[model samples]
Structures are given as structure tokens and as C-alpha cells.
Target chain A: MTHASLALESALRQVAAEIDAQFDRLLDVPDDPRADLYRAMRHAAIGGGKRLRPLLVFATAQLFAVDKSCAARVATALECIHVYSLIHDDLPAMDDDDLRRGKPTVHKAFDEATAILAGDCLHDLAFELLAHEATHADPFVRVELISELARSSGPAGMAGGQMMDLEAEKASFDLATVTRLQALKTGALISCAVECGAILGRVPHEGRTGLRGYARDIGLAFQIVDDILDAEGDEALVGKKLGKDGAAGKETFLSLLGIDRAREQARMLVDQAIAHLHAFGPEADLLRDVARFTLERDR
Target chain B: MTHASLALESALRQVAAEIDAQFDRLLDVPDDPRADLYRAMRHAAIGGGKRLRPLLVFATAQLFAVDKSCAARVATALECIHVYSLIHDDLPAMDDDDLRRGKPTVHKAFDEATAILAGDCLHDLAFELLAHEATHADPFVRVELISELARSSGPAGMAGGQMMDLEAEKASFDLATVTRLQALKTGALISCAVECGAILGRVPHEGRTGLRGYARDIGLAFQIVDDILDAEGDEALVGKKLGKDGAAGKETFLSLLGIDRAREQARMLVDQAIAHLHAFGPEADLLRDVARFTLERDR
Candidate 1:
């Protein structure tokens, strides 16, 4: 394996371990009637995934020389948002998927009602984690983090993207429309992860321009690669049912550009994403490596 | 009408109008494909209700000489949380209710998937509103508001209460368990509306104890009256299906104590709630009126 691939693998594992421990500590179910709900939340949050968003948070925070504990809190909050979205998206009325991260989805493992409440509770807890003093010493920073996360994850962000995706399944979308949908659905949260780390590190507006650029490029690449995987990748390795987009006739980068062109586009975006980090020295090596890994990752 | 009731009536009308307008402005569906999701959010948020939580926020903030705009924003945020909860609770998997506020529930008006997304988006927008500068001049106050709202609405609060209530359907609950369930499910967000107003007003910790006590008493009384309404209220006036708790054999205050005793308990709680404000003068007259209104309100 290349040095960057090895480094990326090690960093991903480290952040995943840190975030898992944080979620376990944060999501302890009390011995009460609501223990079931707590258990459901724990099942959804603490259970496995790539932990890519949290890794971005930790990696970007490292660039700013931010403390590990603070980054862990932010990463955990981001993961909560991501997990809640997945749980909701898997509902019978939504994607209706029975599997997530290679296990029964929340609604499948628990009851649908429990799954809905657990998702709602997890969403609330994400903000709670960000608002805590332990997340950051400065109230301004905490509020900023909350604002950015909320915006990115709200109507014009992930939810909006999902809505667009639902519409896309019914109608063929052009390249621009598909790009916008991908940007909102998956790109927004990914960008927020990086921006949050930058915020925690007190990266100024000028410094953030490059990071934002990096996030945008990688965000699209991430989604394009996702489209590629959904079309052709192994379901076991992907940890989810693949080819659903094609089955549903959903317009994705892969549908719009075909696999070969989509692959070329993702590679171009990753290179451009890496270019954005050129202004930083070796401090952004992990981010650069992660950008490359996005194209190479099977899941 | 008595002077206090008349004053509260006017204040409620004014704030409800203000909040309705604010929600309309904030929830505008852009001219895009995701406009349907935005429409669902608008329908859930702007549709008819008592706007009681927003009224509490405005009334409590009035005591602190806080700006009306700031209070309005906080009130709007609180309303978002309240409406989001209602949307989720009315889901087919949860309460399976078709009606809310004299209109079709969000899921009925839109679809179940849209309803879930709308609720999720509103939940995010609540934090976004609280974190905005328009919510407060002080970032510390905003962070505190976010933290308090998150805690009140999360696992240990509203979500936990809902879980307990769901469990109550399967097994009988005693008076204490019922009270605890009501406190977490309904009381937390109601109390949060008052507490957030106090925070924006910069109420001292000592000053807040009375408010907290007042909130706790009123919260119980609010739920007791809800039980009473479910058992006795006109379906049209109540604006939703009634007696579902009894139908589901869910344990409630009315079920535990009978109608007469439950009404008596609610009255006693209301009087006690009023007693918490004895230290303040007529500035608290509106709060006292609201506590009384909780019992007298048919819907």
C-alpha cells in the first residue's frame, strides 16, 4: 500500500475508535422505561459506519492545532447528524432499506416508532453536544459551530438534497441539477465537517476560502464515487445495498456521465481538492490523502 | 373578560401574529425542485395552533425588558421545536393521527416521507434560529438557550417522555410514573419556552428559581388539563382526534385519579403555579393569567 493510503487507514481507524468511545459515554441508557429508546439511539449511533465526517473534523482540526477532545465532541455531533439522517432515510416511507452498515436498520432492529423517536432524539443530542462548554471554551465558537451545522443539515442542505433525490427518481435531471442535488444531499455535511474543524482552530475567513474550496471539490468527488459504487461496487464491501439508484432510475453522476466519465470526473475533483491544500505545507497531508482515498474507497 | 385575561388575550393575538409572519418569512419555499419539502415545513409550522409556547417566551421576556424582536426569534425557535414534535408524533407509525389543528396532518397533506423530512428540517431550523444574532445580543445567552433547548427536547426530556408514554400503552403506570412521563414528554419544551425567555432577559440564577418552580407547576397542570380535554373536549374544538390515550389504554392522570380528582388536581397545581410568582408584582400578572388559562382552555 502507498504511504498515503496507509496513513489514511490508520487515521480513519483512530478517529473511528475515538468517536465510538465518545458515543458510548454520551449515549448511556438509564435503567428506566425509556431504556428502549436509549438502546435504539445507542444502536443507531454507536454501531458501525465509515466515520468519514468525523475523520474530516479531526483532520481539519489538526491543521488548526486544536485539541483532540474538542475535535472529538464536534466529530461525535457530526456523526449523530449523519446517523440520524440515515435512520430516517431508511424508514419504510423513505428508502425502505432493511440494512445499514451491514446490519438491520434502526426501524428494522427496533420498531418503526422507536426508530423515529431515536432518530429525533439523536438529532437533538447532536446540538446538545455542540452547545456544551466542553465542545469549545468560547461561546462564540460554539454558536458558530451550531449555526453552521444546522444550516448545512437543514432545509437547504442534507434534507433538501434528499428531497431533490426523491424528485430525481421520478424525472431525469441534467448534470447541473444532479450536481446541485449531490452538493446538498451529501456535500453540505461533508463541507460542514471540515469547516467546523477550521472554526475550532480559529481559521480566519481568508484561510477558510481554501478549505471551503477543498471541501466543495471533494464533496462532489465523494458523491460521484458514491454513484459509482452504487452502480457497480460489491454490496458486502459497501455495507449497503448497491445499484438502488440505477434500479430506481435516479439521476446520478454515474447515470448522467457513465462509469468511465464519472470516474474521470471524480479523479479530476480529487486532484483539484488536493490542489486547494497546496497553500498549507505538510499540515494538510491527511486531508490530501483522504481526498485520494475517496476515489479509491469501495464503500 | 377580567383585566388579566383581556391583556393576555391581546398579547397572545399579537405574538401569534408576529410568529406566524416570522415563520412565513423563514419558511418560504424557494423556486426549486425541493420546494415541496419547504411547503411541507411551512404547512406544519404555519398551520393553526394556540401558539402557547411562543406566548410564554414573549411574556417571560417582557419581564426582563428584552427586545421584542429577540423574544420573537426565540419564541419562533421554540415554536419550531413544538411543531416538529407534533409532526413526528402524528406520524402513522407513532400516533397515526389524521388531523392536527383543524387540518390534515403533515403526512396527510404531503406524504409520510415529506412529513419526516419537514419535521427533521424544522428541528434543525430551531437550533439555527437560536444560534443567530437575532435571538440575542450575547453569544453566551444564545449558547445557553441552545443547550437548554437541546437538553429539554432530547432523550432525557421530550423523547424519553414519548418513549415512556409509548411503553405505557403496553403496561399500566402509576400516578408518579404518569407524572414523570408527562413532565418529560410535554413539560420539558413548555418549560423550555419560559426558560429561554428568562435566559434572553438575563435573569439572575436566584431570580430563575421562581421561574423554574413556576414552570414545573404549570407544566404538570398543562398535561393534566390535556388529559381532561382528551376525555371531555369537543372534537372540533380540540382540533384533533381525542381519547386516543384511553383507547390505547395508556395510563394518564385522568385514568389514575378519575375526572373529578384530575380536574381538582389540575386546579390545585394551577393555584400553586400562581403562588410561585408572588414575589413579583403585576409584571407577572400575564404569567398568572396563562396558568389559569391552561385549566380553562378547552383546546
Candidate 2:
């Protein structure tokens, strides 16, 4: 791997560790009857996957010299939200996936009731973490983080996107419709992660605009790569089912634009995403590297 | 009806109308592909229940001279949370009820997937409302409201209580255990409604203590009456299945204390609740009347 790629991998690992520890501390199973619920939550949240959302939070927060400790809490909350979404999305009533990250999905490992409750609890925990004083010393900044996260996760955002995706299975969708679907389904939270860091560091309005541009580009690039990976990458490496999108006849970026065009578009987005950070120096090296990594990662 | 009872009834009707109208305005089904999800959310939230939680919020906010407009927003959010809980709780995996407030449950009305997504979206909407500037002018107060609501709804609160209740069906539980379960499952949100109003009005710490006491008493009394109605009230009037608790052999206050004793306990708790509000005068008459109504409500 190149030096930049190695650095991104190390940073990702560090943030993953930080998030895992936080979840451990935040969700220690008590010696009570609810221990099973807590265990289900831990099973869903703690075990696996690339911690890309939290990495974005950390990398963006680093751009403003924000403390890692404060950023860690936000990262942890965002991951909780991300994981909860995955848990719910994999439910029998939703995707009906039995496998996640090469292991049994929460509903498969636990009961469907426990899986639902665990997802519900984690969603609550995410907001609770942000509302706590520990997230930021300034209450206004904390509220801003919450406001952005909520908007990104709510009906007009991630949930809305999911609803759209569920409907998409019934009929064909155009490129623009698909783009908007990815933006809300996946882009909103990614953009929120970047914006949250800026809120924490008190980035100026113009600087935030630039960061948002970077976030938007990388968010799309990330989804494009995701589609490419699902279409072509190894299932064992992906750690879940692959080609299901194509099998289900879902219109993904690759299906709409074809593999070569989709790969070209993702690379172009990564370059554009990197260009948005031209205002910063080496301070944003990790963010730049992450944008490039989005195009290359298999999972 | 007594004059106080008549006043309480009118006030309840008015607030219920206000909440229904607000939900209709807030959750208008967009002419989008996901309109079904929106419809499901509206079905769950718009046309149901006593609006008791919002009434508690309105009543409590009135004590501190909070603006009705601001209080209305909080009330809307609290009602959203309450309704979302009901939607999820009625899922086939949970309580599995087909009817709620004389209408088909969300999952029954829509598909289960839509019902789950609707509930998820409403939960997100509640926090989004709390984090919005319209909820409160002061960001700190908004954060506090979010924090309290998150805590009340999260694992250690509502969800945790639900886990315990799920476990309780398998094994017999004592009175104390049952009481704790009811407090966490039902009482937490009711108390949160009262506390949210106090937070909005900027009630002093000492003043909050009395309100908390009043809320705790009323919350318990409310649950006792629910148990009594479940055991004896007409299913038509109750608008849902009754005697399920007895059929399930779940230990409720009525099961433990018996009918006469449970009724007596509810009355005693209502008296104590009123005494806690003795510091206020006629301005708090609605709150006192509401507490009394808890013991007398048939549904």
C-alpha cells in the first residue's frame, strides 16, 4: 500500500478502537433481566465493519484542531446511529438478511423482538450521547450537532431514502432519482459527520461550505464504490451477500452507468472531493487520503 | 359531571384537537414515492388516544407561565414519541394488537414494513423537534429536553422496561418488580412530559422537585387505572382488547393488590399527587383535576 493508504488504514483502525471502547463503556451489560437486550445491542454495534463514518468525524475534527476525546463521543454516537440503521434495514420485515459482516444478523442471532428493541435502544443512545455535556463543553455546539444528526437521520433524510428504496423495487428509477436516493439514504449521514466536526471546531461559514462540498463528493463516491463492490467484489471480502442488488434488479450506479463508467465517475468524484480541501494544507491529508481510499476499498 | 370534571374534559378535548391539527400539518403526505410510509406515520400519530401526555405537558407548562405556542411544539413532540412507542409496541413481535383506539394498528392498516418504518421515522421526528429552535429559544434548554427525552426512551428507561416486561411473561414477578417495570415502561414518558414543560418554563430546581413528585404520583395512578380498566372495562369503550394481561398471567397492580386494593391505592396516589401541587393555586387547577381524572378515566 502507498503511504497515504497506509495512513488512512491506521486512522480507521484507531477510530474503530475508540468507538469500540466507548460502546463497551457506554453499554456494559448489567446483571439484570435486560442484560440480553444489552447483549443484542452490543452484538449489533460492537463487532465489525469499517468505521468510515466515525473516521470522517475524526478526520474532519482534526482539521480544526478539535480534541479527539470530544470527537470520540460524537463518533461513537454516529456509529450507533449507523449500526442501528443497519440492524433495522436487515430485519425480516425489511431486507430479511440473515447474514451481516459474515455473522448472523442481530435478528438471526437474537429474536426479532430483541433485535427491534436493540435497534430502538441504540437510536436513543446516539441522541443521548450527543445531548450529554461530555459531547461538547458548549451547549450550543452540542445542540447543533444533534440538530444536524437528527435532520440527516429523520424522515426527509436516511429514513426517507430507505422508504424510497423500498418503493424503488416495484419499478424502474432514473439516474437523478437514484442519485437523490443515495444522497438521502447514505449521503446525508456522511455529510452530517463532516459537518458535525466543523460544528465542533467552530469552522467559519465559508469553510463549512467548502467542507460540505468535500463531504458531498466523497459521499457519492463512497456509494458508487459500494455499488461496484457489491457487483464485482468477493462476498467473503465484502463480509455479506453481494450481487443481491443486481439479483433483485435494483438500479445501482453500476447497473445504470455500467462498471467502467461507474468506476470512472467514482475516481472523478474522489479527485473533486480532494480539490474541495485545497484551502487547507497537510492538516487535511487524512481527509484527502480517505477520499482516494473510498474508490479503492473493497468493502 | 362536577365543574372540575367538566373543565378537565373540555381542556382535554381542546388539546386533543390542537395535537391532531398539528400532526396533520407537520406530517402531510408528500407527493413522493414514499407516500405510503408517510401515510403509515400519519395513521399512527394523527387519529388516536386521549392525548393525555400532551395534556400533561400543556398543564405543567401552564404552571410556569410558558407560552402556549412553545408549549404546543413540545407537546407535539411528546405525543409523537408516545405514538411511536405505541406503534412499535403493537407490532406482531411485540404486543401484536390488531386494534388501537378502535382503529386498525399501523402494521395492520399498512404493511408491517411500512409500520416499522413509520414508527422509526416518528421517533426520529420527535428528537428532531426537540433539537429544533422552535422548541425553545435557549439551546441549553433544548439540549436538556433532548437529553431527558432520550434518557426516558432509551435502554435504561422505556426500552429497558420493555425488555423486562418481555422477560416477565415467562416467569412470575413480585409487586416491586412489576412496579418498576410499569414505572419504566409507562411512567418514564409521562414524567418526561411534565419535566419537559418545566424545562421549557425554566422552573427552578426546587420547584421541579415538587412537580416531579406530582408527576410520579399521577404516573403510577394512571397505570393502576389502566390495569383496572383492562381487567374490567368494556372492550368497546376501551377500544382495544381487554383482559389480555389476565390471559397472559402477567402480574399487574390489579393482579397483585386485587381490584378493591388497587382502586384504593390509585385514589391515595391521586390525593398525594394533588397535595404535592398544593403550593400552586387555581392556576394549577387543571393539573390537579387531571390527576383526579387519572383515577376516573375509563379508557
Candidate 3:
């Protein structure tokens, strides 16, 4: 990796660790015997990952001169949604995967029923966390964050995109169809992270729009890179089983377009993602770094 | 059966038809081609068994001298959540049931993946409908409805109960455990329907509390009657396969207390459910009727 990329990774890791610590404080389980469910949910959520989504929440808030700590609930809520998706997607009824991030998947580590209930509980916790705001400087800003996150993670957003991807499996879909699918499946949450951060940061409407554009390109580019890695990356290095996309006969970007074209498309998306950050000037340097890293990451 | 019970059946059937008609008008397909998903979702929701949940919503709103139409979106949303649960419970990874309400389960009629996606989409759509002002008289009321529904359906609520139910399967559970599980799984939504309607109607807090107590008893009685029927009712008469609970080795009130004792307990709960409505005078007549009918139903 480049020196600049390594530094970006280090900074992101530190910010993510801080975010995880905040989440641990927030998840104070009650004394009820049923509290085991809460323990399972926290265990799945706090387990380590890149924490890219929460970092976006923190980074975008910093860009608009907001206190990073003030946005912890929203960032934690965003990660809860992401973690819930992972839990449900790995269920025996769904993807039925056994490994994720080099650890046993939630269902494999616990039980299928626990995993389902865990996902359901986490999904609700995300909204509850947003609704029960404790630190927002402005109540209306919190409402904006809640409403944006609700819409982004909801039917017209990430969940909708997932259903579309399920339908698109092994089916021939046009570029437009694929774009629309990815825009919701992956792009919606990414865009919501930035939008929520900007709202909490009190960014103007124009800036919100610009940051959303940046998130959208980077989100799609990130997925394309994922598809590329799945086709070629080593299983031991990537952490999870690779080539499952091919085995599942998924309609991935790499499958739709040859590797060279897919790589070229990813690069173009990274460029566009960075261009949208021009409004933030040097304040968005880390965002640009992440966009470049999206296409450059080996795993 | 009894002449009074026959009259109750006619009233319930008429109410179900009216509620189904209203739901039909509200089913709008988005412009996206994935709109079929919403359509299939409606198929799982409408054209099912008795609209008991919606009836509770309308009946509870009526208790506050509010128009049933005032709670229509919330009524629909409650039913949406109920239907989504049924679909998910019928999946191959869960109960793996082939029939529900005398028809093929969603996964049996549709594909498993579609059933899963439909259930997921329905959950989000329920919230979306509640969030929209077109469904309710006031925005604040809609928000209240959304919050109440989430509380009833989420982790510490219905989903929590579902986990207990899964755990209870193939295990010996005491009456306390069975009751707690049933209260969460079935009683949560029933109580929520009644309470949410009162909130939408802007009923006084004390009256809302009384109505909720009334609904809770009715929910418990309803489940007790279901347990008895599972042991005594015919598959054809019940409109679904009977003996399912026993076949699955599920721990229910009947399994804990035996048939006669369970029936006696149900009668007591029904009486208590009706007695709680005494404070409401004539406004709570339909709720009384529902409680009575729930206890006396043969199938």
C-alpha cells in the first residue's frame, strides 16, 4: 500500500476503535434473564471490522466542524443497521454462510433462531438509538438524522436493493438495472451516513446534495471492487470464502463486464466520487483517500 | 353452534370483508418493476384468515368515539406485521409449514427467497405507511403510531417472544414461561393495536390504560383458546393443518395445563378481558364482543 493510504487506514482504525468504545458504553444490558439476546446482539455488533460506515459518519461530521463525539449515537445506529444486515444475510434461510470477517457467522456461532432474532432486535435498536437522542445539539437536527436514516435503511433503500439483488441472481440485467439495484442495495446506506453526518453538522442543503453524490459513487465503486476481489482474491487473505459470487451465479458487475472494463469503470467512479468532494476543499481529504482505496484494496 | 356465536361469526365476516376492501384500495404499486414484490406482499397480507388485528384497531378507536377510518393506516400496518410474521414462520428454515389459513404458505406459493424478501419488504412498508400523513389525521399522531408499533413489534417485544417460542419448542416449559412467551408473541401486537388506536384518537391517558388492560386479557384468552383448538379442532374446519403444535413439540398453555384446565383458564381470561371494559360504558361493546367470541370459537 502507498504511504498515504497506510496513514488513512491508521487514522480510520483509531476513529473506528473510538466509535466501538462508545457503542459498548451505550449497550448497557438490563438484569432480565432475557438479557442473553442483548448480549448476543452486542457481541455480533462490537466484533471488529473496517468500520467504514461509522468512519464516514465521523469524518463527514468533522468536515462540517461538528464534534465527533456528538455524532456517536447516529454512527453507532448506522453500524447497527449494517451489522443487522450481516446477521440476517448470513442466516440459514438467507445466504447460509458460515464465515464472515474470519470469524464464524452469527448463525453459525450462535443458532439460526438466535441469529434471526438478533437481527430483528438490532434493526429495532438502530431506530431506538436514533429516536432516543441524548447528545444532539439541536432536536430538529436529530429528527432530520432519524428520518434520513429511516428512509435510507428502509424499503425504498438498502433493503429494497437487497431484494432486487436476490431477484437479479443469475438473471441477465442491463447496466441501468444493475445501477438502480446497487444504488439502493449498497449506495443508499453509504449516502445516508454522509447525509446524516452533514445534517448533524448543520451542513447546508447544497452541501448535503454534493456529499451524497460523493457517497453514491464511492459506494458503487466499493461494490465493484468487492466483485473483482471475489473473482480473484485468496480466501485466506480475504478472510471469508472467495468465489462464492461465481458459485452462486450472481449477476455481479465483473460478470456483466469483463475484468478490464470493470476495473476501468471502478476507477471512473472513484474519480467522480472525489470530484463531488471539491465543495469541501481540503476538509474532505480523507474521503478522497477512501474513494481511491475503494478501488485499490486487495481484499 | 350457539345462536349468539352464529351472530358473532356473521359480524366478524362482514367486518373482515370491509377491512379487506379498504386494504385493497390502499395497495399502490410503485413505478419500479420490483412493484410485483409489493403485490406479492399484498397477497400474503390480504385474502388471509379473519382480520382480527385490524378489527381490534377499529374497535379500539371506536371505544374513544373515533372513526374507524381514522386508524385505517395503523390497522393496515398491524396486519402487515402479523402477515409478515406468518410468512417468515412458514419458511423452510423455520417451521417449514406448507399451509396457512387453508392456503399454501407464502414460501410454498412463492419461492423461499421471494417469501423472505416479501417478509422483509412488508416490515419496512408497515413503517412507511405509518410515517405518511395520508394514513392518519395528524403528523404527530403518525409518529406516535410508528413509535408504539416499533415498541410492540421489536426486540423487547414480539420478536423477543418469538425467540422464547423457538427455545420452548421440544422443551418442557412451565406455565409462567408459556404465558410470558405468548404475551410477547401474540399479546404484544394485540395490546399495541388497541393502545395505538387510542393514541391516534387522542384518548385520555387513563382510558388508554384501561383499554390496554382489556386488550391484554383478550390477547391471552385468544392464545389459550388457540392452544385448546390445536388439540381439538379439525384441519378442514380450522382452515389450516391441525396438530401442528403437538407435531412440533411446542410448549403451550395446553401442553402445560392439559385441555380442560386450559379451557377453564381461557374462560377466566375472557371474563377478565370483558370486565376491564366496564369503565368505558357502551363505547367498548365491540371489544367485549371480540373477547367473548374469542373464547367461544370452535375452530
What docking class should model 2 receive?
high
Q: Which residue pairs clash within candidate 3?
A: none
lDDT of each: 0.91, 0.89, 0.77
> DockQ values for all predictions?
0.92, 0.83, 0.30
Clashes of each: 0, 0, 0
**Model 1 ranges with Cα > 4 A deviation:** A1-4, B1-4
Q: Candidate 3 on A121-181: residue-level lDDT in tens?
A: 7776676666553647454565556567767876678877876777676576788888888
lDDT of candidate 1 over A20-131, digit per residue (tens): 8998998888988998898898888875998999999999999989999999999999999999999999999999999899988999998999999999999999999999
Residues A1-299 of candidate 2 have per-residue lDDT tens digits of: 23347788789878878889999999899887889999999998886888889999999999889988999999998998899899889998888898888889999998888888999999999999999998898998988899889889878888889988888888798899999999999999999899999999998767698899999999999999999888888888778888888888889898899989999999999999999998999999999989988888877
lDDT of each residue in B1-299, candidate 3, tens digit only: 33235545676776677767766875666776466666667678777677888888888887666665667777888887888778877777667788888888887886776677677666766766766656665555665676678778876678878877777775677888889888998999899888887887888676576787788898999999888888888777677677878988887898888888888998898888888887878667778888888887766
Give the candidates in order of TM-score, highest first. Answer: 1, 2, 3
Query: Of 2 and 3, which scores higher on DockQ?
Result: 2
Clashing pairs in 2: none
Between prediction 1 and prediction 3, the one with superior DockQ is: 1
Tens-digit lDDT string for candidate 2 (B52-153): 899999999998899898888899988888888888889898889999989999999987788888988999888888888888889999999999999999
